[model samples]
Target: MTPNAIAEHFDTTRQAVSKHLRILTECELVTQKQQGREIYYQLEIDKMKEIDKWLEQFRKIWETRFNQLDNLLATIKNKKNE
Candidate 1:
């Protein structure tokens, strides 16, 4: 979407949206195309997928840790009841 279009969904200024778009464009997360007077931005799906894949590892680790904590708490509760 164009910067103005994206800005319309948010309460921020058009310049803030443009600034964020610029950062994303620089990071290769979004690509920009100039069509006449407007610059349209599109997300790089492959780059996003790469990011998701990288974050998946941490997600799994955190889930396991949370489960372990739950088990530990259950054990403590059981011991208290005993």
Candidate 2:
């Protein structure tokens, strides 16, 4: 999406959105193409997939913790009812 479109979804100014997009571009997480007067940005999907793969271990850990928390809450609720 163009910076304008991205800015509309954010509460900040268009310039702020552009600034972040610039950083993302610098990080090689996104790529931009110029068409006519507008520049459109797209995610570097391969980079994102690499990031997701790296984060998968942490995601599993968090999911396990959340499930344990849910089980504890359920036990508390059962104790309260009894």
Candidate 3:
């Protein structure tokens, strides 16, 4: 999206959006393509996918922890009844 479009959606100044776009472009999270006078920003899908894959590892870990918590709670409830 163009800086103006993004800025309008976020209720921020175009300059701020441009600055963020610049940073993201530098970090390789976003890529820019120039067409005449307009430059369009696109997300680096591969990088996003890599991030998702990395986060998936943590999601599995959290699920295990939550399952353990549920088991512990059930055990406590059973003890209370006894």
Candidate 4:
């Protein structure tokens, strides 16, 4: 999408959207192409897959911690009942 359309959708200024687009371009998350006078940005699906892989590692860590917390809470509740 064009930067202006993205800015309108997010209720943000065009400059703000441009800043974020620059960052994403730097990260290789999005690619830009010049079509006449306007620039269009499109998602780089492979780069997003890289992000998904990175996030999955963290998701596993958080899930393990949440399971431990659930066990601790259950233990506390059982002790209270006894």
Among all candidates shown, the one with the greatest TM-score: 2
> Which digits, one per residue and each the tens of the lDDT, describe model 4 over residues 1-82?
9999889889779999999999999999999999999999999999999899989999999999999999999999999999
Q: Which candidate do you rate higher for TM-score, 3 or 4?
A: 4
Best by lDDT: 1
Task: Supply candidate 3's per-residue lDDT for 69.
Answer: 100
State, as a TM-score between 0 and 1, how close model 2 is to the true structure. Answer: 0.80
For model 4 the TM-score comes to 0.80
Looking at model 3, report the run of 10 residues with the lowest lDDT sum: 3-12
Runs off by more than 4 Å, candidate 3:
62-82
Candidate order by lDDT, highest to lowest? 1, 2, 4, 3
lDDT winner, 2 or 4: 2
Displacement of residue 53 (Cα, Å) in model 1 is 0.6
Tell me the alpha-carbon RMSD of every candidate: 2.4, 1.9, 3.4, 2.2
Q: Compute the lDDT for candidate 3.
A: 0.93
For model 2, the local distance difference test gives 0.97
Pitting candidate 1 against candidate 3, the one with the higher lDDT is: 1
Clashes of each: 0, 0, 0, 0
Where's the lowest-lDDT run of ten residues in candidate 4? Answer: 4-13
Q: What residue runs in model 1 are displaced by over 4 Å at the alpha carbon?
A: 69-82
